[model samples]
Target: MANYTDWNQALIDYFIKGTPHGTKIYLSVDEDVIERIGYHFGQSSTNVIWVNDFCIAVRIKVIFEGQVNLQHLKGRDSQGLPKGVAFLCATILAASQMAQEEKTSETNYFKRLREILALDGFARPLGMKFGNEAEEPLWREWNRWLMEDRFLPSAQRGGGAATYINYPISQSLLRRTDKDRLRKLFQEKQWQAEWDAQTLFAHVRREAGAFGIHLKDLLTENKQRHEAIVEALHQVYEQWKAQGCPTADKNNYCTWSRHLFCGLYRTEEPFLGQVDYYLYPKQQRGRSLESVEVKQGDNLHLLREERPGWYFPLEYSVSQKELDNGAKYQISSPNDLDYLILPARDFWILIPDAENPDSGAYASWQAPSLGTEFILLCKQELVSDIERLRDEHLLKSSCTPQPIFNNSGWVELQQCMVVSQAWDGVFIKNQALKDALQPSVKLLISFSGGLRVPKIGAWLVNHGPQITIFGFYSTAELKVTRLSDNQIILESSQSTNTSIRLDFSDPGHYLIEATFAGESSQRLVKIVDWDELAIEKYVHPEVMAINSEYHIFGSVIGQIF
Candidate 1:
């Protein structure tokens, strides 16, 4: 049996052989260490059958493998095994289990571990191998472990006994060792004796390099990078203060851009375009010709944050005779201009004019919903346009409205549909009811959140690329149409004047309401027939490039609007 002291020395020898450059490998093994650590392993045995950590844990199964090999701490075979210590370090590091010492930080330890482990089988071929210049006592000790199971051990197989094989302990447990304990272990003479002053300096230099710091500056008599970094920060603050102290002086104000200041300032009226208090059109264009009249208090204004090339809400005079038809704006408070808060990069404080409340506001609003029809329109008009102008999603993929239709007009590969919110709205017509029954067809409804049924009417023709029949109804039934496909059409009577095509072969989502004559329906397009190859290229372009620029753009921003 290998005594604790002999086993300790065996482990030390195994580690020392790998430290060609004399890097200290810290180990905390003592007379009572195994017993103390055994508690953590949920074992009562003081013999330490195994040691484990979060990253790598191993049990010392036996001294060696059958009769073919005896497991010495540093033992290696012709095939390879000598670099066990180095391998252990590697396993620990990859598991992020290196001890808490900054000197032995995971990165540094991992780097050193790699170098030593690489020596296993290759060292003998390199000639300056294990037995070169070996001392008598050291060899005796190593052989004792390999043979008599005193320092190392042999294996037991098929009911036979073996001894001395050292397996890795739990890397997680190793990392959990207290910082002070690790430091004390490093202070051992075995660790200090491995390196001379020069080797120590080199080690320090290597560690410094990992942090991208120069060794000379790090070890110099005076503190170097620390002071310089502090000075740089101070200079930045001084410059910012001198530049009018813009955001620093205002309350609830923060400057997101170094060149500009933005935030809410006090307002004189609640109706003032107080960005925080009022909601504005998410998008806006200049008002129409006749709609551009400004009251006595209203004047063409530019927003401080909304500048040269940016599109945002702003007052502009439509009067052809006015010289100041459009003028750049300066930052002003609510007293001067009522501002509404709209969410942007953070939040954009916008100014709203009461005289012409809708003056700078957006016109022709589209209903906000996750229904299939909306998604299809967005993919067609908005996504295509955005991709054409800029090779990116018009609406970022992160915020793209999810389609409500099961197939969702668009096909998704890895993309997942998340209905972050619930909505009640119009649905498409039912094909079964369209042909057999009356002119009006009722649609079966289904959706995630609880919603009320809505009354139906042809709200707008050609609302999107396709005509939309607005209906007042809601339901949770899985199937909407009598036909397997999710299609709904206007009852026969309502379809007479509509120029919209009712050709649909897939399922859909939307609202439908029962009427005395028949039924009214708003349709949600489930899957519009699209070239799969074209869509794939749009969704993932480099893989499949459809020959059209339109397809290219659509792929990038398929849900722009």
Candidate 2:
């Protein structure tokens, strides 16, 4: 294996091939210069063939590390100012100011690039403007944030520098599973105990944000983007391995993007749901009902007495028209009602868009459905509360069977059981599994007590959501082992077809190894405890609907939804 020094040397030697890389290296970890005779051993030294080059690298690290002194900008002696900081100040500089500032005055480095979104040109005018910087408030804000060291580099803070966000670093920072892989590759242990790799990473992130650079997002999205990308990559790699690992040098020149197999770790994403709702923004205007405008400073509050278990966070809009007595009032944004969205559930989330096969009321956001636009969101652990809400008559009338948004394209809303595991080392032990992964040769191992799979939480979390048996199949050896302890639970020397339903009495994460020819493919499997999984998966609880006119306060009664 190539040592850490070889890797770092390659990054610097190969990446800084052009002027663009030279200009951008300040934003890269490659600029962190350190010299040692024995790999990651030995004391740090600045000895270098080119003194100026070493100086440049040192300077790049300092600025991004957030120790930038604004006053130092004026003290630099003419070698084109600090390289990185200067470029940033230039991008946002007012043209008039740029012209007035002295060329030798310190200014260097462009902040991380921000994408310019071209708005509706058809609806508005476009024009060109010039200056030391455009009057972009966003840039100003980023400038301030990146210039500080207060920002932490942990998962909560954007994990990577703005320039490198989305590029490996931030991706690792966003995902818990990616951290160990990155740390191992970077030889991060050499970092000072206090100013450790993580701390320095935070420093880089802090400075990037202070500079008003747009940090790429990982959490803003309800569904993660990386999971799908990794999954697809794994599938491709498996197919390639099963086909004999063809290479371009062998006259193959086939298309393939190779990715290192990072070890898999359990990952559980929170299940959440959102639905549009209506409410009275202001305090109840009992009996003497009259419309009142919610002022700019008005605080919207939810009536707690109305629903005991459900807590309403102020989130909706009201309409101007009168509540036209209609059964399905939640669908239309009538001028008569206030509109709002229900908060998403943090855990056990059951989005109720239940349209009774018989209820005369029908209300929908966009999907074809009818009922009060109510979603039942409760902690998965809150079994009693979830049960009570499911049984509530008023809630049943509001929340109904509706379309749930799942960006992952997984078959249905899955329970938090069976968390996702990061990529693991896949050993192609069989010839068919090595370089000839037939899409038809999929090895599916399902769990069932006997031969029959239980519908109880088994189907949703343990197996059957994705059908891998698309191509012809060959006999492959199958082994199921308990991951928590590495105990071999079951083993079969030969299995035909693409699917095999294996019974697993115990619940937890497992490792399923399927071997074809001589190669074997392994991936993580999570078998959630039936008890815990049952709560997340729906168990058809009875709920009554109170479809009638309701009162707002003690004195006022109106057709409120």
Candidate 3:
């Protein structure tokens, strides 16, 4: 019977010789480790069994097989057995008895516990090779617990002639030996190891010349410093102040600013914790960016950071013409300077003046509802347009030609629609719907965010060509029809997205009719030859002669808009 220490060393030696690489290998027992059973197999050591998530399975096979092999090698009534064969037999029998005592279920930890004890003396290595077919499930089993260590074991498995297969563990700089305790601790700290080497061989066969070697010999490295974070924030503030800050500023992304928020960390192998930390920040759940630094010349608009993602000065766009003197505007508030507070998540858009028919009103109007109100203000210069309003929706009825102290003027207050409101902001939409809204030019005629215009892929009328189409409507459904034959191409009831793919069996000249919110429009196109570069090249005799002599290839295929 081999002692615990001897068995432990024997298993490690077996792994070094029998298994493939030092990374992490499958189940195996060397002939040497088993042959030694005759010398010291019956002795017992004080050390208990330790098993990791993966090798626990491997160790189970080794323990069970060793037990069966020992039984077969020595008879029950043998007089002179191996040195510790009797002791080994007794230990295996004890484990079998313990395993039998435990109840069986879908997840029987007791059975596993017995197996773990049977092989605890030997080291069951943890760690895995990502970027491979085998190690995916092993590393992705996040619920299982793993022990931390000083050693960084790499399984090159380069699977090449030159790839080395040596597994080595380095000495620890700081030692820690703690027994298992309840409540797993979540240690969130930065690492200070060379990551360049790990990424160096990551998915081997990376262009060797492309990546130059990097060396970091730091006597002392400081990652998280309060002074550093504050300095980085101020630097961002100064940059924002320098630029004549615009209305919107989400395009700015500073690496130093982000680094200050999250300190540096390093790891040899790709760990889930590190990956999660890096990727979590990228999921912006809201309508806009996390936060923006806005400035406008000397008049810097200061905002109070009440919460993490609350936005002020809503980043709606406006043209220079709207702000010009003697120009008109339909604004949400009386003063353009009045800041807009918005929630972190919602659908938002800047409605152009041409699309909004309600902008025809003159005076400021307010609609109150649910302890809040939505306000709409018209520019003073828009009085001329308001004066022309004779429609009942624009001006109130039953007005008499009454004279007033203020002559040559008329004042008529019209009704405005009331929408909901919350702590973030108010919502408003007018009931005065336009009979014929303009077509969407800014809003694309795309096919699921792709291909704004049709392409002729077929060479002749008999060949088939694919055409993708999409359109969006604000107030009502968008109906797209083939105008040449009045065939309805596609219909999207409401909302933004409308996608469809069409395959023309017989190609020819065609026109599409698009009716959006009662407004009608058309797009004319033709499906022609796709083989030659250009129509001119095939038609012109001079160009064809040059092409036939040279036997050259070039693309003169201009895209249709």
Error of 3 at 299 (Å): 41
lDDT of 1 by residue, 1-561 (tens): 333233333444433331211011233232122322333335454443432321122112111221111134345435333323322333334333333343433244334333333322211113212232221222323323232211111111111111111111111222223222222323331232212122233333333333322223333222212222222222223223333333322211111111111122212233653211111112111111111211223454333222211223334221211111211123243232222222121111122221122344321121122221211112222333323222321122323533322342321111111122111121112211111111111331212111112111111222212332322233221212322343444443332212234333332232232232333222232232223113223343433345543233533633222
Candidate number of the best lDDT: 2
- Alpha-carbon shift of residue 363 in model 3 (angstroms): 40
Clashes of each: 56, 80, 10
Report how far off residue 228 is in candidate 3 (Å): 51
RMSD to true structure for each model, in Å = 30.8, 26.2, 32.2
| Between candidates 2 and 3, the lDDT winner | 2
Candidate 3 to native Cα RMSD, angstroms: 32.2
Better of 1 and 2 by TM-score: 2
List the candidate 2 regions with Cα displacement exceeding 4 Å.
1-471, 494-499, 517-520, 526-561
Across residues 13-95, which tens digit of lDDT does each residue of candidate 2 receive?
32222111001121222111112111222224323332133334333433333232223332222432222333222222211
Global local distance difference test of model 3: 0.24
Query: Would you list the C-alpha lDDT of every candidate in the order shown?
Result: 0.25, 0.27, 0.24
User: Model 2: how far is 205 from its true place, Å?
Assistant: 31
